[model samples]
Target: MSYKTILVHLDTSVRAHPRLETALQLAKRFDAYLIGLYAVFEPNARAFNVMAGSAGYYEVQAAMRRERAGALERLFHAELTRAGVSGEWLAPGEPADRAVPHHARCADLVVAGQDDPGDPESYIGESFREHLIMSAGRPVLLMPYTGFFATVGQVPMIAWDGGREAARAVHDALPLLKAAGRASIVTVDTKADDAGPRIASADIAACIARHGVEVEMVSSVSDAQASAGDMLLSRASDLGADLVVMGGYGHTRLRELVLGGATRTFLESMTVPVLMSH
Candidate 1:
């Protein structure tokens, strides 16, 4: 398997350039068609109109949004031309929470940046990363908010949970893993009451072996002080892993996403590129 089409979600965020650069490198490596998507989220104006607002204010707000979108489009085109890669720009009027996933479904992979929790105006909503990973039905390559990643999928570390989500992530990452020089599968065993049935990590390693990846299995027990996600990152750092493969886990509550503990922790302090699937 190979990536033939790559979709990158870009916006007014400062991190968009680095994320685009990474996507361009990946596209060039795979000779894939790159699609740049810029989505502008419109606030709910109906609520504002009830208080002291008029239709005139709404029109002004929309005009400002259009101007921002136009600026983003110009930036996108300039970068695409400089890169000299086969690509297209898409600026959709819909909110990013819905529009990104819709456009990502047709791409082999989606590239995006990790949201800055403190930035209220983050191009991608603070929670949109997890939401898109769950809804896109494709693999998402997420770049941390503060870092420069010139290469990825070279040496990967897989966080294995032996669950459906983990399995799906491993499957989705087959193309990258197969191309990597080496990979390590890290599994952490916790002492929780409902930890589910035990599974051998070697079995998963054997399956990956068929794909010609130089793979190894590492296992550890998680303690109260350090969670599974912490252990995984520690191992990744020790092994100098450039890419991490894992599952994105979350549940919707009252239309909001409540992520699993490990999933949340990983995103909050991620130090390397992560390929996640739900």
Candidate 2:
């Protein structure tokens, strides 16, 4: 909503030029404090990074890591300087980049990149933007890897299921959606499903309508054999939806997101942008 402090989750992995640019624009618009945090994850886990081998090799490798980390900050800060974002950079020691959640606790909002467009093979690998939403303890706004969004929440798609997760996303998205000219809520095959999903969809639509939003609700079913993500994507495409706002449909058990059907499809194959809240 009217964010005063916005913490953008920066990646030192691939050059996040687009993400950095978008963050600066958002920071200027909200007139908020912009924190450009470069998370220094473990060296062992980085495929492109070299490991500390012998005593002789350790110094060289560590120095290279520090240089790369510094380079990333300089490039990012240059954009902030150009855009006048009022930003600060941080590279934590112990948890490295993993400490982003803790740092986000003090901010009103968190912004994270969606995927790396340069590396087709490793883009959005095990490292997903969804983790930011699930673990951030706050609503996460996922900035797309390729788009040029100066201000988010402009044209958004709302995933309506009448569930707690969907409700939270809607409440979290109100700041943006209320500012938009139009917002759409999507429900899959409300006509085919039993009373449960249908009722849930209706309830979600009704709840948001009370918010005084100029909204439209659409219910469409997949081809029956389509993947869950595919169905949602297809519907969004058909609606010409620019962004999708929904719950972070995650697994309740071990892996966080093992439910592994439509959710995984949506995460992987989405052509349109998504705004997920857990």
Candidate 3:
């Protein structure tokens, strides 16, 4: 019902500070224990040795990585101290794509950064966010790569489609909705075939209201030129929403994961923080 433990992924990117700040704020708000997991991409030393014909380069890279990790650990601890929140730092020497999801499962919520194509330092791999959302088995809160969000969950908009994934997302975000005191459930490009007559936005609104959250239902019909993701973002901006809660839609095909069109759009162009669950 409440977030008791929050796991945040930290990397050697400029945006790491903002991500940590967001996690710290949530930790303080929920009175939860915070875990800072330091995971970054490390090139294969063996491959480097084969190319350079020497181990010296590998040693140098390892040493530099250690130094950066140590600095990040110190920063994380200091910030936690200043925030008066209890937390611990972890550096599991493993691929972030695997390690993050392994650690994230134990926490109630996971905080991660959106992939920045321009920042190679933070790149874990392709479809990292989609993989995390699918494998974490918990809600993931992703911070935008280009924004400084001092406040989250103040005014939230829920992207609803009445599917299983959307249902899971809405419930996973219940704590934030209750804390925010108000939320808007926006259904974009609603079609009778998509959401059956048995399920309606009003019904979900009533359910959320029972939890003491003031819920508003907003329905919009999107034009052929506009995508559902675009409609959702425009509505959020118009409502001055700081957070968006929605389902991360994706599926595996031929050992590759393909995110839904709307999900892909949000991951690539989110202006505000987004909380997604699969």
Query: Would you list the C-alpha lDDT of every candidate in the order shown?
Result: 0.83, 0.66, 0.89
RMSD of each: 2.6, 4.2, 1.8
Higher-TM-score candidate among 1 and 3? 3
Candidates 1 and 3, the one with greater lDDT: 3
Q: What is the lDDT of candidate 3?
A: 0.89
As for model 3, its CA RMSD to the true structure in angstroms is 1.8
Query: What is the Cα-based lDDT of residue 118 in candidate 1?
Result: 62
TM-score of each: 0.88, 0.78, 0.95
Candidate 2 Cα misplacement greater than 4 A, ranges: 45-61, 115-130, 146-151, 189-199, 209-212, 252-257
When 1 and 2 are scored with lDDT, the better candidate is 1
The stretch of ten residues in a row with the least summed lDDT in candidate 1 is 117-126
lDDT of 2: 0.66
Show model 3 residue runs off by greater than 4 Å: 53-59, 190-198
- Highest-TM-score candidate: 3
